[model samples]
Target: MESSAETELGRRVASFRELGGLSLRALAAAAGVSSSFLSQLENGHTNASVASLRKIAAALGVTPAQLLDDTSVHTRGVLRAADRPSLPLEGAEKYVLSLPPLRNLEVYAGRFEPGGSTGSEAYVHGNSQELFLVTSGEVVFQLAEERYTMRADDSIEFLSSVPHRVLNTSDAPASVVWINSPPTPNESPHAPA
Candidate 1:
């Protein structure tokens, strides 16, 4: 008999994949596992070993704990604002963003102090789509050849593959929520090419 914990883990894993808009075949390809095997695991018809779970977690851009834990609200996988992890970007000053464990789609809450910007130049991430919501103060977003000034309560969604940058245009701090599909590369700013 499958333990409740195991079943919950499987359900969470399945939900995470769905939230990321990944088909079983796509996740299987990324995890180097057979699609049938992934299906079986999702259905709780087979026990998944730790090693297998590790592979799945890596493919999903999450820690195994995020996959196995039953703490999140099952309906929406709500991660409380205080619970997200802070991630620093390269060449950005007075800025920090909460990059939640990517068990599902990537969601981040960013804060930028006055005069802070994402980087000196724009960047393109080919594998994902992005949604940006300005929560407070003001932000200047440069997307490709267009520039937009966003104020509180404004939101924009676009292809992440387009060159984009964010600048805090106010004298006070600015806050924005950024959501992305799939996962961005885990390259460190200081890592050598």
Candidate 2:
């Protein structure tokens, strides 16, 4: 029997895919999944693996957590730390720092373990303005061919459309705060986004 969570995930996936005007085949192609598998997932006949969920979320222009979220419960208010949503990235943990109904801005906090990275392939989102601040330790931001090494209290601003990646090559952990103005639909809801 399908669990409620699985049913809800299927519903959310179908909803988002429809909202994006993507056909089942189109979404499957974009997410690198078989159409039959996606169909089964949408029908709640099966649950997606985390890797599959991540791929689907990326194709849907959202985070895996967003796909699993009961967004009806999200509201604008002072969100307590414990109530904040978190996403585990590759060797890093990302905390969503802003309340839902995000419009003008979105915030995220990332803690990168030593040698952690935001993957080798850089990611690009809509053309929103972005600010990245290194709150603790050190980090390297690779934007296209440009590279910047930032340390504690250091900050940088750039257009979010640039293909970029974040890395902590140091032996110690690193923390960063990222901000985006006029949230974009294509922005990933975790890590440096």
Candidate 3:
């Protein structure tokens, strides 16, 4: 019999595949594995090695941890507000709201002082999406050639594989939650450009 963790892993794997609308054959092909192996994994009939899990995760456009999570709790796997991780940025303080050991998605709670900004540079990553929700104060986001001003309770979602920046324009400290999918490979969550 498979361990409970392994069972949870299988369930998450299946869920993610279904969410992505992938057939077993298609997922197997993308992950460079046999359909039989993928089937065994989903059925909890075999233990999946780390290499195989990584391949499946890459093919599914998510982190391996996301594929292993059992998000059955009432919080939907969210980290409590007080338990968020704090990451130092170049000009602002970023508090990560999502639980780590994450898979396809990441959520953050960021606090920025007046006149602070994420960065002035433009960058791109591979196959990533991000969302920002202004929980308090005012913020400005520059995406490509467009400029957007966000107030409290506002939200924005966009592809992270483009040049973007966030600015705190209010006199009071601004707080927002930043969520991203598929943690950028080996990128450091606290690294500020």
Worst 10 residues of 1 by lDDT: 91-100
Score every model by TM-score: 0.57, 0.58, 0.56
- How well is each residue in 8-30 modelled by candidate 1, as lDDT tens digits? 77788798787556789999899
The best candidate in terms of TM-score:
2
Q: Which wins on TM-score, candidate 2 or candidate 3? A: 2
Name the better of 1 and 2 by lDDT. 2
| Candidate 2: stretches off by over 4 Å | 1-75, 186-192
Worst 10 residues of 3 by lDDT: 71-80
Best-to-worst ranking by TM-score: 2, 1, 3
Error of 3 at 46 (Å): 16
Off by over 4 Å in 1: 1-83, 90-104, 182-193
lDDT of 2 at 114: 90
Q: How many clashes in each candidate?
A: 0, 0, 2
Best by lDDT: 2
* Model 3 alpha-carbon drift over 4 Å, by segment: 1-83, 191-193
